[model samples]
Target: MSGGVDSAVAAARAVEAGHEVVGVHLALSRMPGTLRTGSRGCCTIEDSMDARRAAAKLGIPFYVWDFSERFRADVVDDFVAEYAAGRTPNPCMRCNERIKFAALLDKALALGFDAVVTGHYAEVRQGPDGVELHRAAAWAKDQSYVLGVLTAEQLAHSWFPLGATPSKAEVRAEAEARGLSVAAKPDSHDICFIPDGDTRGWLASRVGAEEGAILDRSGERIGTHPGAAAFTVGQRKGLNIGYPSPDGRPRFVLEVRPKTNEVVVGPKEALAISELAGARFSWAGAAPADAASGFDCEVQVRAHADPVPATARLEDGELVIRVEEPIEGVAPGQTAVVYVGTRVVGQCTIDRTVSAVPASR
Candidate 1:
């Protein structure tokens, strides 16, 4: 439990189902103050306390597992490195992929635990071949996109007690009825490691800010940026360009080059991307038999972004995705979660992209 309503309710349901349950809250931060308060970030001292109280109410054993070092190495350092390489990465996805499922699940299995149960809003179903991951019943509260990283083995040993719940409101209500104190606790947001919500400021301190040139689509230098690593593709607020576009349109960040310390800005239309591909990939449960022959699917990049119709196939040891419509502001380092109907089939960390708009145009 994150000392939140969802996880507390999830644990309550697990215990209610007549299974022996243990409430394990991960201590992910060595320095707790770095975790912000007031609905911004999680893993705080207050959150742990809340979790312990909920466990006491549920009459289960509660323990705080120290995963600080592993979390820092896998999620925190990876975030810094990805930003320094000028790629926008989702640290939550990395946490789910590396720490939560891989490291945590591995440890749980070694301890003879059947599965690592959590409060994620996703479903696990027994398929004909094996267990498969699917979206929650409600699309609005579905989180299968992040859980898309789970392999067949991981899915087999995972449980989401609240997956079939209708809505978050109902979870909160259940928590309240169960006498759980965290029934109304605000959901966490932003990067947990960053105390404040200012990501660019936090990155500048670690990556070491240095001035860099901001160029337009036609290779025209328009302005300078405080740091190349601080900007991400699709960002529009902080460009600080001196002049406006000829058509008086707002320009978005098209690219960031950390090697040369350059930020590329262009009209929003140039952000349209036709294709994305990645070398690092994994399937949810079963690999598509026709993956080499190309198969129809849907791709989602962000946590809440709508899925787009696409075709996926393996080519030269990479997962290549071709979307039916143009995707805007797609950059390298984002994970593309592919779906066939409601089930999560596979995912890939995007390594490259092909733009729909020509450079000169």
Candidate 2:
């Protein structure tokens, strides 16, 4: 449990279902602060106490597992490496994929647990073919995108007690009705590691500032930036370009060339992407027979992003996606989650993109 209302109520629901649930809170940071930052981010000492209290109220055994070492090595290091390589990564997805499902689940199974339960707002159902992952009933709070990295084996041993909830408000109310103290706690926002939420500042501290030239689409130097790692595709603000566009329109970041230490900016139209290729593909359940050929599916690039109509196929050990309508700001290292209707079919970490501009591809 994360010491939040969602997890508290989820534990309650699990208890009510007659399962002997033991609450285990992950200590993700070795040096967590004693005070809460009022931002509701995880790994606080207060959160650990709150989780203990919830477990006490539920009358279940509780323990804090120290996974800080593995988390830092996998999620934190991967985040830094992705940014240094000029790719935008979703660390939450990485956490779910590496820490929660892989490491934690393996530990739990070794301890004779049949499954690992969490408070995630996603569904796992047994279909005729096999297990399938689906979006939560609460569309706004659905977290199927982050859970897309789960393979078929992981999904078989996962449970989400709050997946069928109508809304987050209902979950909070359930927590209140159950006498849980965290009913009104705010939802966690921003990256947990960067408490101040200054990603650029945090990155600069680790990667250091490498002064570089900011170029336009035609490779003409327009300005200078502290580093290419600070910029991301589709970014508009903080360009600091001295002059206005020739067409008197605003410009956006089109690319970040880390090898060249170049930040490429251009009109928003230059950010349009029609195709994407990704590596490290994993299917949530059984791979579809037509996966080798092209199959129609909805592709989601970011968490909470709208799924776009697309054709997906596995070619030469890579997942290639061709969207019916061009998507903007697709960056490498972001996950490309594929779905057929509401069920999560597969996902892959994006490696590259094909822009609308033929020359750029």
Could you say which candidate leads in lDDT?
A: 1
lDDT of 2 by residue, 127-219 (tens): 778999999999899999999999999999999999999999999888989999999998876788876778899899987778999998789
What's the lDDT for residue 161 in model 2? 92
Regions of model 2 farther than 4 Å from truth: 33-36, 358-361
RMSD of each: 0.9, 1.6
List TM-score per model, in order: 0.98, 0.97
Candidate 1 structure quality by residue, lDDT tens digits, 1-361: 7888888888898899988888989899877577776666887888889999999999999999888999999999999999999999999999998888999889888988888889999999998878899999878999999898889999999999888988988998888899998888888888888887889899999998999899998888999999999998999998899789888999899999999999999989899999999999999998998999999999998989999999999999999999999999788999999999999999999999999999988
Displacement of the residue 327 alpha carbon in candidate 1, Å: 1.3
Off by over 4 Å in 1: none
Number of the top TM-score candidate: 1
The models' CA-based lDDT, in order, is: 0.91, 0.89
Write down the lDDT that model 2 would get: 0.89
